[model samples]
Target: MTIWEMLAVFAAGIGAGTINTIVGSGTLITFPVLLATGLPPVTATVSNALGLIPGSVSGAIGYRAELAGQRPRVLRLAVAAAIGGLCGAVLLTVLPPTAFETIVPVLVALALVLVVLQPRITRAVQRRRDRDGRTATPGDRGGPLLFAGLLLASVYGGYFTAAQGIVYLSLMGILLDDTLQRLNAAKNVLAAVVNSVAALFFVFAAHFDWTAVALIAVGSTIGGQLGARIGRRLPPQVLRVLIVVIGSAAILQLLTR
Candidate 1:
């Protein structure tokens, strides 16, 4: 790749890592850059997935404070994410790319809607909990419904890798009783699990552009830390708006390209 192209990928990686940490749509930033840089679709997807692993891990670490009491939650969700990710990776290798194209845009749109309505969803959950005279404890387990939703989201993350964070946030916001920042921290861990599991398969079975991977790894790691710092300070409404806007952009990108 040209130096300029490498620079662009690196820049995208930074933005992606930041966004992934804050909200969950970083792939939307980096994947198109890879495509523009001349990688074929599948190769770009594989390389992008591998490249973002470090950023995801870094983002998770950056949110370690929020993650402190969520070990059981993370562990349970990780299982679903790992299995779903493996299934999605296998599908990516075996099925035609067009197989998922039609559905992805719809998923992005749905995620956007959920993000926009998150405040209402949270309020409703709060009311329901109050009616039941239940107080939210730190050890709240998400149960089977959340597991199913997360598994489906992980499958989507494995296959497409765009806007999966928004999906996770939407599910977690409604299903899990916690602050958005805490749920976001959990989102990063789950996303990392899905990406890491898929990356493991891609590393063995798929071709990649290592330069792209390296550039993104470095850039996204930095971005992840930056995002965690900024994201933790933003008001919930502002963060939700940002997520909706980015999710809309992801939908537009997918529909147009």
Candidate 2:
């Protein structure tokens, strides 16, 4: 790649790392930039996945305070994420690209709607619980439904990796009675797991550009730290709005591309 193209990819990586840390659609930024730099779709995808690992880890580490006391929950959900990520990675090798092309946008759109309605949904469910003389405790682990939904989202994350964060946040927000910041912290860890698993699979199954990987890795690592600072400071309402806006952009880009 030319110097300018290289710089663009690096910049995109920073943007993606920041956004991914904040809202989970960082792939939308890095993928197109990689494409513009002349990498093939699969190559770009593989390289991007490989490169973003540091950013994901960094983001997760940045949220370490919020992760306190959630070890059992994160671990349980992680097992499902790992299984689903492996399946999605395998599908990437066998399935045609078009298999997820149409469905992906639909999934993202649905996730956005879920995010928007999550507050109301949570309230309604709480009311039902109240009527039944029941209450949610901190020990609640979101049950089997959340597990299933997270598994599915992880599969998608492993496959395409665009806006899987939004889907995760939506599911957790509605099902888990916790602050959004905590959920966002979980989302980062889950995203990291999916990306790491898929990237490992791609190492044996796919081609990649080392230059692209290096650029993104370094840039995203830097952005991850920056994102943590910005994201943690945002109020819950602002954070939700940010997720919605970025998710919408992800949808539009997916549809147009």
Candidate 3:
């Protein structure tokens, strides 16, 4: 790639990483930019997956505080996620891409709806928690349901990972505690394992656009740092609004692309 093109791609990577760290739609940005640059769809998909792997790692690392008491839980769930991710990656290699393509519109629509309603839903849940007059226990997280949901989410991630964070959040609510921030932390680590294991598969078995991956990696790693800083400083309301707006835009762009 020429220097200018490299700059553009790397900039997109930074944007993608920031978005991924904030809302989990980084793939929507990076994939289209790569496809527009003339990379084949599958190649872009694979390379973008590889590129985002580091961002996921950094995001998880950035959530170390929330993860302090959840090591055993995270490890147990990680086993399920690793196996599911491997299965999903194998399916990605075998299934007709069209089968999964048909779900993109529906997935995008759901993600948009989630973005719109999550705040209201969270508020209602918070009210319920307050009324119950009990301190929220993080241990109440539903491990089995979470494991199952991770399997389903991984299938989608393996096929086409765009706005997957919403899916994880959606599922987290079902089986986890009432705290949004804690759920968000779990979402990050789970996503990291999913992307990393699948990227490992593509690295060993598939052709990758290393130039694009490298550019995205460098930019996204920097973006991840900024995102973590912002996450530390921002209010929950500000974060919610930003996540919804960007997530909505990302899903819309993915459908059109």
Q: How many residue pairs clash per model?
A: 0, 0, 1
Q: Candidate 2: where are CA atoms >4 Å away?
A: none
lDDT of 3 by residue, 141-251 (tens): 565767887777777876677777777776665556545566667777877888888889988877789999999988888877666666656665676677667666865
lDDT of 2: 0.91
- Global lDDT scores for all candidate models: 0.90, 0.91, 0.74
Clashing pairs in 1: none
Off by over 4 Å in 3: 111-136
- lDDT value for model 3: 0.74
Task: Sort all candidates by lDDT, best to worst.
Answer: 2, 1, 3
Residue 214 error, candidate 2, Å: 1.1
- TM-scores for all candidates: the values are 0.96, 0.97, 0.87
Which TM-score value belongs to model 2? 0.97
For model 2, the run of ten residues with the poorest summed lDDT: 134-143
Candidate 1 lDDT, tens digit per residue, 170-248?
A: 8888777788889899999999999999999999998999999999999999999999999989988888898888888
